[model samples]
Target: MQLRLQQRLQERRQQSLYRQRLTLSSPQGAEVQIGTERLLCFCSNDYLGLANHPQVITSLQENAARYGVGSGASHLVVGHSGPHQELEEALAEFTGRPRALLFSSGYMANIGIMAALLKRGDAVFEDRLNHASLLDGGLLSGARLQRFRHNDTDHLKQLLQQRADVEGKLVATDGVFSMDGDSAPLGELATVCAEQGALLVVDDAHGFGVLGANGAGSLEQAGLSAREVPVLMGTLGKALGTGGAFVAGDEDLIEGLIQFARSYIYTTAIPPALVAATLVSLELLTTEAWRRPHLQQLIARFRAGAEQLGLPLMDSQSPIQPLLVGDADAALRLSEKLRSDGVLVSAIRPPTVHAGTARLRITLSAAHNEDQVDRLLDALQRHA
Candidate 1:
């Protein structure tokens, strides 16, 4: 069996499908040291560049000195501390939600939300291009999971009509799609879900720190209220530069999740220090309006340059900008070409993306200036 596994791995390598990590010797920022080359990295999910922000780092250090290290227990077993509680309140208010509950990660939060609200007879309608985590949550809930055409509201309504007899029908989507870098048709989806008596769940993992007034996320951008999109799940990992996620909803949903969500109740609580860092990140994400505005400018600049170079950019204004490279081998070659020119935009290939749509994911952050964006464009232009 071991030999067969090794042979299969070799076959992947031959097919240009083997994946490996690029080691970074420094903190995550616009510029990073990959091996000996200092490249302008454009592949991080850190949109607001809070991952290495000085204030957030200071808050973590100060809180860790006071709180020691780990929580040492699950939240339900007396590990929930003042910092965690404070952060939850802050999250709820920031999201315009009545209550919120924290879990260890976005993956866990989705699983917990679905499993707690849905049972064997329940049904879930989801976008075909939603994050894999959401799909896993539906699968784990033992619900009848149905996939609608990507961002196609008509298909969603058709599925909901088909499953009208189900005890529970929840429609879920990603605010900003992970690989494709497009947003869901939120307003249309919300209307359909509302009339069909299906609850809407929006996972704003990539949108939380980058969109709307004061960066309140996709729901805010679309002007949707809690009553319209009932369950909102957003992460602190991408823009907040922390580890954990929260599900924001009304009092009843939050209370029920606390009682029944196994992922929230059974997992060890995140460290108080990490929560502190996240709180500081949230402050920056909310109050500092320039970060979001500056990132938008950078995105526009990059898009304009990519178009002039005839690159296959996606139809998105968010930080995630993907250039479709078609073949896995072609995507890898383009990434290598960029690396050679001291730019690091990662190639995302099959399995992570759909087959035949492997791409170069070029992410923009506030930590990057216009010069860096120009430098990346120059590198791509040179290759083109």
Candidate 2:
């Protein structure tokens, strides 16, 4: 077994697909400390930049003193506290849903939702570019999983037509493709689901707390209601700059998951103090209106500058920007060069993206100023 594992590891390294982690010695922000180097960061998912907000930190500290550190038990056990219930209510109200049920993380939320709702004979349809968690959820649900071409509504329509005899049909998609940074055509997918008598589930981990007028996510931005998109899964760790995730829908859906979702039933709840911090972060998410527009402006500025530099840019209106580089080694080289220039961007290689579509997954945060964006562009111009 050791020999086999070593061979597989060697293969990954030879292909330039080995994964590594960066050690951050400072809090999350536009700039972060690694070792003795201070890097202008562009790979964090803290889009609204509330992760290190003073109010958020104070709320966490206060709540930690009040509730202590750990949840101690699962939500179905004695662990669900005042903050948990309050945050659920606030999230439901924010998403305009009948109820919201929290999960320990976005991956668990997606997995539990699929397992609770699907069984044998049910058919699950997913976009080819949906997040790995969503795809894994469908695969693990004991249902027939079908992946349609990425964002191709026509292909999805045909797949649904072919599987018309299946009574329980589910369509899952990422509200925002994580690697490519392109948004799912939510409006189109919702319409397709309605026509095909299938349920639509959106994992809006990247879109929530960043898009929309009230930061209610891609659904609100697309003018979609809870009825149109039945299952909405979002993460607090991203734009909300907290932790955990939730599924917002009608009361029946939340109740069903509570009763049947094993992941939710068995796993310990997130810390009540963290939830308290999240509540404060959620308020700041909607109230601090400047964050969203400032983030959008940064995205626009980066894209325009990249275009002028003849960079290989993808069509993404969100904060995630990908500069496509065909070879994995080339992508890594570009990332290393940017790091040497005092900027931090992640090289997204195969498995995260396609074989020939390796890219630098550059993310923008509202905490960043115009100068920081220019600094990133300057580094890219020198290295990319």
Best by TM-score: 2
- Residue 342's C-alpha lDDT in candidate 1? 85
For model 2 the TM-score comes to 0.99
Taking all chains together, each candidate's TM-score versus the true structure is 0.98, 0.99
- lDDT string, candidate 1, 233-289, tens digits: 999989888789999999999998899989999999999999999999999876777
**Candidate 2 worst ten-residue window by lDDT:** 281-290
What C-alpha lDDT, on a 0 to 100 scale, does residue 22 get in candidate 2? 95
Task: Assess the local accuracy of residue 180 in candidate 2 as a C-alpha lDDT between 0 and 100.
Answer: 82
lDDT of 2 by residue, 209-306 (tens): 99999899899999999889999999999998989999999989999999999989999999999999999999997678899999999999999999
Please tell me which predicted candidate would have the highest lDDT against the true structure.
2
For residue 94, what is the lDDT in candidate 1?
94
Q: For each candidate in the order shown, give its overall lDDT on alpha carbons.
A: 0.92, 0.95
